[model samples]
Target: MKLENKKVVVTGSEGFIGSHLVEALIVQGAEVTALVQYNSFNSWGWIDSLEPTVKNSIRVVSGDIREYDNIKKIIKGNDVVFHLAALIAIPYSYQSPMSYIRTNVEGTANVLEASRELNVEKVIHTSTSETYGSALYVPIDEKHPLQGQSPYSASKIGADMLAQSYHLSYELPVATLRPFNTYGPRQSSRAVIPTIISQISSGKKIIDLGDVTPTRDFSYVKDTVNAFLKVAESDLSIGKIMNAGSGKEISIGQLFYTICKLMGANVELNIEQQRIRPANSEVNRLLADNRYLKEVTGWESRYSLEDGLIETIRWIDKNINHYKPNIYNV
Candidate 1:
């Protein structure tokens, strides 16, 4: 479906990916409504950093996704709903599992229920590769068994199940996009790429990180956003779960060295004990089989790891003040 002039509502509009998706949707000439998490400071998160014209293009709504009434009110009259809001920090999930369950699971139910009642045409539910846990084989496909090794992943798994149920039971036009490690500008410091870049940019010679041996299929943020768009635009994507990734995999240690090389910095690596996940909780490998997504939407990743890293480094360097590199974000 053409997005031009279609009414679109993005649930986590203040977040990194959501902000980018909002901007892209605006570029596509979609009338946008952004639902930012309500805060006392009236902060719009990354949306606050958008250019003046871009910020003015959308109607901004301050509300919580966990509230069904609030979500229903916001979702009314929109052609599509992009549900991206959730409590996503895995480390913090260990400290507060209930928060993850309430926000991720219940918040998604609110979106789905609201969309169903309002008869929204489409809903793109955001998902994570973490739900797959450690890949039992290379190039994990959509059929790969989901293993919830962490509370965060478990909450996402529950959310995914809810989306599937909505699609099957209510025939809601919902599609789940499971994106791999999406790294780029404006990502939170809780993520590894931002964590590493912020520390290195802060003039830290020794970079502190968790297990570097775990391999991940890192899709650039731009590519991931494109996948969202493609999925929403295609009728074939409804009632489907697809993987959006680069199909290539890299170990965190190798990625670190590559970033160091790209930045022209010789940095020592320090594996912080506090940074590592519990033995069984850590996902050792992930690679994506993006054939289904490709077949359905004709989408593929556009950026290489080095190219994406260069862009990320440049953005993080200029916005260094936004990061507290000295503290572990979790």
Candidate 2:
């Protein structure tokens, strides 16, 4: 299952984590096709920021994931398919649940059906920590019951179930990789890490945030991408659901404080009602149990939380204009 000389298609290569995964596959000597969302402007999202050398190496395919014809065409003849495309903003999901279902669940179905029809060697389906909602126990495992507290999470849960059913009913060579709170460069401002960094770098004395008591297990984007590569390269991961995380929990308040310290910014907390999730929809905590991933693929977190946060802060500082700190990004 060595990736060298293999043909790999990444469905969301224009996204934060997907772009990183595409770069990793290219580094591993794989022939990479980057599937970017189609636009009239032909924007490649985060992939456009890649170095010329790296960007030139990838084949960019622009199409909608929800279109079965487009998916089948792009999936043809590829040895591995990494399905990372989805609508991920939680707040946006509240505003438009149907969009999430179409993109996350139905889009995933398109990938699975295409892979099954094309007989692709491997399919790596992306899952999220949000699928677990608030942890009923410390260090949630793959077997933990899924509780979708938000429309986004619910959509992802449906996607994961679809992947599982494909593996069981059709014998699709699919693996699900659930990542918890991945953060690094190229992440959008909707995420907490980018939100905090953008606001602090804007010279704002008061950081507007929602409930800070919820905790999450954060992993660096590079580490998460590496784990995806490992899962793709390992036959043992077939029909498995694995987690990529640091296995350490940090509350939002604590995380904000750490980021401020790293950026040398003195900021006070300003609880904004608009920034908060609906009371019933908020996930109180998420801590990953990555034991199965370690046992199956020998993948583990490579970066410490502090190191990753510092790197993220530095990236945001340089790319401040890409973010609008004054407005709450839904």
Q: How high is each candidate's TM-score?
A: 0.99, 0.99
RMSD of 2: 0.7
Per-residue alpha-carbon lDDT of candidate 1 for residues 1-330, written as tens digits (9 for 90 to 100): 999999999988999899999999999999999999999999999899999999999899999999999889999999999999999889999999999999999999999999999999999999999999999987999999999999999999999999999999999999999999999999989999999999999999999999999999998899999999999999999999999999999999998988888888888999999999999999999999999999999997899988899999999999999999999999
Regions of model 2 farther than 4 Å from truth: none
lDDT tens readout by residue for model 2, 158-211: 999999999999999999999999999989989999999999898899999999
| lDDT, each prediction | 0.95, 0.94
Model 2, poorest ten-residue lDDT window? 258-267
Q: Give the TM-score of candidate 1.
A: 0.99
Deviation (Å) of 256 in candidate 2: 0.8
